[model samples]
Target: MQDALAAHPVWVIVVDYILGAIMWTLIGRAAMNIFLPEDSNFFFMRFFVRATDPVLRLFRPITPGFLIDFLVPIYVAWFFFMIRFYLMPWLLGYSVMGMLSFPLESEIAALLYQAFNR
Candidate 1:
């Protein structure tokens, strides 16, 4: 019974990886908002920056603390993906999503809804 419960972390890694994707997604949008004139005020883009800025702050040093640098978010997304897809499932025996079933389900539902809504 106790050993059976150990697999939970694999799921957590998967979800965390997805979040890492989101973090990068926001970073991409933030870059566009700063550069491209048209998408500058996209509400969701603003929201992403606001949402991820705090967490990414810890990783900012990887980018040398430069707001304009693309390296931080890009690398972060990559790192998370590696952890989620390769490391977690293959090495840990599950996925981050498997661990975070609750939020992942809602997030997936929301994504599906958004995708189909368009």
Candidate 2:
């Protein structure tokens, strides 16, 4: 595990962290939309809208028109997920596709394992 962590430059980890955050945030926004309007004044909803609006807009051209407005976040999130899962590993010169490219998730899982096993 340490070797794997050490093999990548620090920027790779930082990129993973950022992309993971955006992916999760978009997912969260989709989930929240089930109960709240897009214009809702709730803090988390507001934060989600504010944070993910730019990403959604950036993807607007590629986003299918058939997808209803509520599903747009999930669709955008899928792009980020793919970029992290596939593109990042390729960038790091991994021969295998679908390698464990999610450093942020890896660290969290490791911490949880330590806490529960202790």
Candidate 3:
């Protein structure tokens, strides 16, 4: 497991960056929606909504309205958090013990991993 990650560290970094970006985008979109009108054409707000809407739409049906209103982004973030922290490591051929023992050397991946895995 260590050798695989060490050999192809780029893959792990890419996966972690992509997941972290999406998670933060969802969070940003939710925050923007609080103050700005959903239809607001602000550049960043529009970007966030455009970037995150598809994922949020997919999650919508599973969540109740009350939870969806404020907690939807958080739920989506948590999903990605799980994927980045737990699923990816496991899928990368690391065992449970290996996961706990292997140190993530990529700084960005390591930071996000700590944020989520904890």
lDDT of each: 0.56, 0.86, 0.72
The segments of candidate 2 whose C-alpha lies over 4 angstroms from its true place after superposition are: 1-4, 97-101
**lDDT (Cα, tens digit) per residue for candidate 1, span 53-87:** 66567666665555444455565656655555566
Candidate 1 clash figure, as a count: 11
- Deviation in Å, model 1, residue 22 alpha carbon: 2.9
- Clash tally, candidates in order: 11, 0, 0
The TM-scores of all predictions, comma-separated, are 0.47, 0.87, 0.66
- lDDT per residue as tens, model 2, 35-85: 999999999999999999999999999999999999999999999988887
Best by TM-score: 2
Best of the two (1, 3) by lDDT: 3
Candidate ranking under TM-score, highest first, comes to 2, 3, 1
Answer with 2 or 3, whichever has the higher TM-score: 2
* Candidate 1 deviant stretches above 4 angstroms: 1-24, 27-31, 34-40, 64-68, 94-118
Span of ten consecutive residues with least summed lDDT in model 1: 1-10
